[model samples]
Target chain A: MRIFDPHIHMTSRTTDDYEAMHAAGVRAVVEPSFWLGQPRTSPQSFTDYFDALLGWEPFRAAQYGIAHHCTLALNPKEANDPRCTPVLAELPRYLLKDQVVAVGEIGYDSMTPAEDAALEAQLQLAADHGLPALVHTPHRDKLQGLRRTVQMVRACALDPERVLLDHLNETTVREAKDSGAWLGFSVYPDTKMDEARMVEVLRAYGPEKVLVNSAADWGRSDPLKTAKVGEAMLRSGFGEDDVDLVLWRNPVAFYAQSGRLRLDTPAAGATFEGNSILRGTPGAPDVPAPVGS
Target chain B: MTTVPARHDTPADTGAPGLPPGLDGPARAWLADALTEAARAAQAEADPGGTWQIRFAEAGRRCGPGHADAARVELLAAARPGVADLTALYRQGTAAERRAVLLALGRLEPAAAEGLALVEDALRTNDTSLVAAALGPYAAAHLPAHAWRHGVLKCLFTGVPVAAVAGLSARARGDGELGRMLRAYAAERTAAGRPVPHDLTRVLALTEEP
Candidate 1:
């Protein structure tokens, strides 16, 4: 199965995660810029994070034969932070870059007034840039957050079709489906949906515009949850095409709206002795001296 | 693993020159309609607007991804988009769309160095598909010797087969600077305990003729 994890945070993942993902049929990923576990002090920090997603992370993924792209945003939780609010202003410039597939993780965290302003402003950015959005609904008040999210999406200038309301569960799935937006479910180890539950969601709602992701990060989340969801779907009477739609094509179709998704693996024959991290620093003598047999 | 349909193994599938012939009947029919729409769009005005660009973007889904490149080349020819249109499409278009524009540059009957910026932009990218497309006949026919030499080296670094580079023999033959660059690259790879790309040696041999 060729997998495209529509919303995995590869920035916080290790190199081994990338290798295991590739082995499990993950060929491409979109790492949306979100708040780290701790608060960031300034907008410059966000720019550095965006640059790595655009440059360094993609280079790292290329060594393992995975295509990496990212979505840029002042994430929902950070929108409330005064120090990080400047990232909203910085987002337009980053959105212009080729690797940015969407203006994302941009909905309600606590549904505060500040979060409202940030979400509305970023929705406008996505519209102006002709990109899609990956919205992270509030986890505390599940049904209320999904309601407010759907309402805001309808009221905003951006089309709901361009929005992906992620981290959904059984309580909010029906409303999200009725909202004319793409469906996104993040399978995790403890919270959020698991593989069997994800398969059940697939069973109830046919996998039309649904995108399944691991949403893995620095937390105790599993990056292989997406691959597990694919296996579960197969075991539960879903055909191969249904699995492909949910796992691969749906994400490609959604992010392809940005017209920037490069699915082609750049490092075809460029592996350096199976080590993804070692690019061989030039003129560094302390690094292993070349030994001739 | 999900079984993707294996691409047709006909002779035309292997080479760009014979690509259009490799497409099956449904894809051919789809291309015909798209071309007709593109021609009408070109005749309408210099800027045919979003509808035309959307059609250009849909070539991949309309035809298979394997055949989309050729389908786009045909659309470009039929539309006869000028430099402005090509630039907008390339800038706003996906990697796939940008690649199609680069491939069509040589056949576009361009003015002197007309689409050179597009080729240079594609060369700057690490995407191997875009790099290979940028070094097509357009680059060979027009790109300055300095940038062209760097492009050859870019292929070796990115693992794009040097064979994808159009007019490589004529461009690389008797070029001493390219030979020097290739030698430096090979030495760096060797020092790093990495296998130097075999295509680098093949290109170096071409540069040795002078």
Candidate 2:
């Protein structure tokens, strides 16, 4: 039951999450760059964040046997901030990084002219870099956001096949599929699509270019949703091949278009920089037994 | 039952100096190539800073992180960076990179106290790894007695094992002030109904030694 969560924020997550995700057979992940919970004051903040996504986060993931790749962008929400727009200029060099499989989480937050410009610029950057674009649709107006996003894809240089429209629900799924772009569904613990709902989508849409993700971040989300979706698919009488197509193969195929998508986990016991995710000792912690037992 | 890990008063194994021992063949080879590149950059009349910095940043990816520190130390050693270069690397580098610089300080300039600022900077943070790395032989050999004592207390405070503090026994022995500090900390924890760390007792015993 190998899994590849196409969009998860490992930077905001912890080592415990990594252990559980690895145990659940999450062999690979693609962390799209998104705004921190608070607004970043400068474009330098985005560069540092991008560096972590490239360097530190991947190292952290490798320690727990998960191969980590990231998509670099200004992100839709930050696009409106003039302070963050300079990061758009920096995206080309970041896009050239080996671990960067796409330029993404780049779409509309408010559908402002600034967002339109940033999204269009990043989509062009993706096209120039020969990478896929992970476009996040606005959470407020479901169908309208998808329509506007699909229109942008139609107008932009990036082909629809090279785009992935994310945060989709039933209302937007039909139009997103009609756009000829990849369809991405985020299953959360409570808010977004759950395992049963995801399985139903697979049944309705027939998982061809569909990618399911946890979209887990600082918010309340689950990193194990992909595995749960796989389990739900199995229970729904979908064959193992069907499960593999939706859970693993689809993400690999889309991101592999970048000529990146490294899926190899590093050797066991590898540390990141000087930090190993170890505390006390690897197999021993001197626990003071039940006091006075 | 409580286990007391082995204590080392020196740098060899404590600071992760030199190429980490037992690196598998491929890792060793990758490190060799990286070091050679760094050495060549250093030998050039005008060192290409970006080249070496890139190699330093990529060590974790190329050599694997278990040996990344060893690779970084060797890169620093091979490049023979001065205080300014080390300072820039520490300030601009990530926490991991800063740690590699701290660990390399002992080997880069064994006697000079030039790297103390980096050590002090690391000690201020609660990052256990940085705190542990900051207390490496460089700090043990150079940090003033007063600062060193606080670092030890910090180890206990952050739950970093006192064992990670290099030269613990020699420094802690016969230090009445350290004994006082340790006792006060224990009393505070007791007053708050917190379980005193097993390490507090261990260090307290060390301070009690003549």
Candidate 3:
């Protein structure tokens, strides 16, 4: 099972998490830029975050043979933050880079007016840059958020097929399915859908354009949820091909829209910007000077 | 683990010495069937991954110059539709999609003309990915030796790792001509104080008869 976790917050994860993920069949991941639990005071913070996504994180994932790609956005919650809004202007350059697969994790956090403007603006960015979108339905009023999200998305110039309304569950799957957009369910430890529930969605929906993710961020989320979903699907009478379709191919199909996806390439290298994920420091003296001792 | 079909152990499946013979074989047949299916519903879009493309993806065919590699050939069959409608897709698709088409062409003629044409066009591009893709498994089997060697240099010039050139071993080994070209290119880069590409060393080593 060569898994591609279409959505996992590896930025909030560790090197060990990457190793565990690789051991568990996760071959690639997309770490969408989103709200970091606390509100960021400025866009400079986002600039640094985005840089790490393109650089350090990729290098880190490469150490374990996982390909790392990211989806960039101001994020729904942050769109309301005037301090972080400057990121919207700075997105074009980053969006054009090869690793950025989509304009994402962008949609209603609170379903605020500011979010609406940001979402509309970013949707245009996706259209301009020719990338898909990974949208977040509002958790508080998800049904309403999903409704407003589908409406605004249909109204936008972006193609509905290229849009993914993420964090979906039973309440919103029907509308998302009817919207001609892609479906995404984030399985988590507590709040979001779990593996059994995810399997139910796959059984009901038939897994056409559905994409399952772990959405494992800094929150108390399980990174192995995607693999678990695959297992659950198999246990529930789904075929191996069907499991492969929902977990592996679906994400590849979604992000391959960027035309820059090269999943076959193995990423392996250690140093970056004079820093090393390796053990030894260059030109450093040996720990034990036997002669002196 | 999911039950992936074991690779066909036939001579062509290895691609051990060169790309599989495109001349009337299972490789050719699989490609034709895929093309016919792809034309009808394979997402031959400018982009590689789309809903229609999922069929090809389900066939487990990735968007590359189609390789005869095991995993690639498995999805050659699926719950797919037709392929006769591919002319426009072949003519108008993006380099990525076009590369996919060329890959699926194998060695079948007439249709081979279009695939080879796209391969030639890709070779002419400055786009490193496209140029690298131009030398994929399909190109490895079909591109003439001269154009193939130049393609190797292009990989060096463009900083595309030579490994991306599918048949590096079989193509590079014992090719004295390629060895000379690589040496001259490396010397020129050294003289200009431009660091020679790291891959030049690997391919230069591959030029060894052993």
Candidate 4:
């Protein structure tokens, strides 16, 4: 029951959740950068966010013994905001970092002109950096959003196979698959497809060019929806292999196209180096005096 | 009272009885006094406006690489008392330090639950890093409420760094019961749109036994 959750946000979760996911057999995860609950006010915020994604988040995962990877993107919802331009300018530095697997969660929300420009700019960045693009389709007008995504990918001369169209419903999944783009289904608690529907999608799609994720974040969603999808597949008489392909293999294969996604394993009995990232002082210690001092 | 054996059981090598090998009597006395004073200062400065910066800087200066023997001396003393004085050496310590202290206390005697509770209450600070670091390690062994786990999940997924998640995971991994509780917590948390920490992802990667 090994799984690779292609789209998850570790920043919103606790260590217990990590332990739980490990218990459920989630082997690897790809965290695609998206909007925080509120729009980030400055480039520094974005930088901090990126640093955490690549730095602290992975270290945290290692404590739980999971392999973690990430994608970098300027989310579509925030692209239209005037303050986003400076943040956008700063994204290139992050794209060049080794842990950035894709320029992602970066498609259309409202299909505004500014969003269009921002998406195109990011798509170009992805192409220039030789990274994959994780496209976030609109919740509303999804069909039109999917069409625009395909049109933009083609216009940008981006490799279709290197793009992942996320949050796809049944209406847009076919179009995304037809366009040679990787299809990602976000199994939500209520709004998006549920576990049963995700299993049906897998049954219909047969696991090629498809990946299932929770797209879990601060909003209303489930982090273990991917596992539930696996559960659903098993209940449907699908072999463990089929469940593995849909939940783990497919996402890993799709995101691996970026060349930056590396599945890490925790080292046993590893100690921190004096100059290592973890070797910083957070607080002071309490020591007792010698008996006669 | 349940007596959990010492987490680390390696025997200490006492160089010489009266004069610890590397340190002179005055140096040893100085080291011991400095450490005791630092500990008292840290406790006094536990409040937000406390002289934590000064205390921490002094502690760091005292804990140079050259003080390897000093570190060993502290560890030996802590082992006898069953408290993690080494972790406390880091200045301006967070709830994490407090937890380590409490766990050490718990190992010494079961009545340490009061100390654990105080540390747990301190976790409600506005500082996300401090809260995460403090609660992350103990969550596995303690298995606090789903909301606590939810907060941790949020930190890890929304943009929290992998390193923090790894730290929390390692701490949680120490207790199997806590580990199982965390798995269930992860399912619920992820269901609500939070990302599972990487440690859970590793657990998921395991091949189920036939």
> What lDDT score goes with residue A44 in model 2?
92
Candidates arranged by TM-score, highest first: 2, 3, 1, 4
DockQ of 4: 0.01
Give me the runs in candidate 2 sitting further than 4 Å from their true place.
A279-293, B1-210
Instruction: Report the poorest 10 consecutive residues by lDDT, candidate 2 chain B.
Output: B1-10
Tell me the lDDT of model 4 at B204. Answer: 30
Quick one: best TM-score, which candidate? Answer: 2
TM-score of chain A of 3: 0.94
Q: Per-prediction TM-score, please?
A: 0.55, 0.56, 0.56, 0.55
Model 1 chain A, poorest ten-residue lDDT window? A284-293
Q: For residues A156-220, what per-residue lDDT tens digits would candidate 2 score against the true structure?
A: 99888889899887767899998999999999885557788788778989999999999999988
Arranged by lDDT, best first? 1, 2, 3, 4
Pick out the ten consecutive residues of candidate 4 chain B with the lowest summed lDDT: B1-10
1 or 2, which is superior by TM-score?
A: 2
Candidate 4 per-residue lDDT, tens place, B46-68, comes to 33433333333333234333443
Candidate 4 residue A62 Cα shift, in angstroms, is 1.1
lDDT by residue for model 4 (A1-293), tens: 88788889989987667777776777788888888864454677878998889877876666556778888877776675555567878888888988788898898865667789989999999999988888888764456668988999889868888888888876667778888988888988866678777777777777787888988887787788888988888899899888887887778877787786667664522333322323354312111121122
Assess candidate 1 and give its TM-score to the true structure.
Answer: 0.55
RMSD of 2: 19.7
Over 4 Å off, model 4: A266-293, B1-210
Q: After best superposition, candidate 3 residue A284: deviation in angstroms?
A: 18
lDDT at A264, model 2: 73
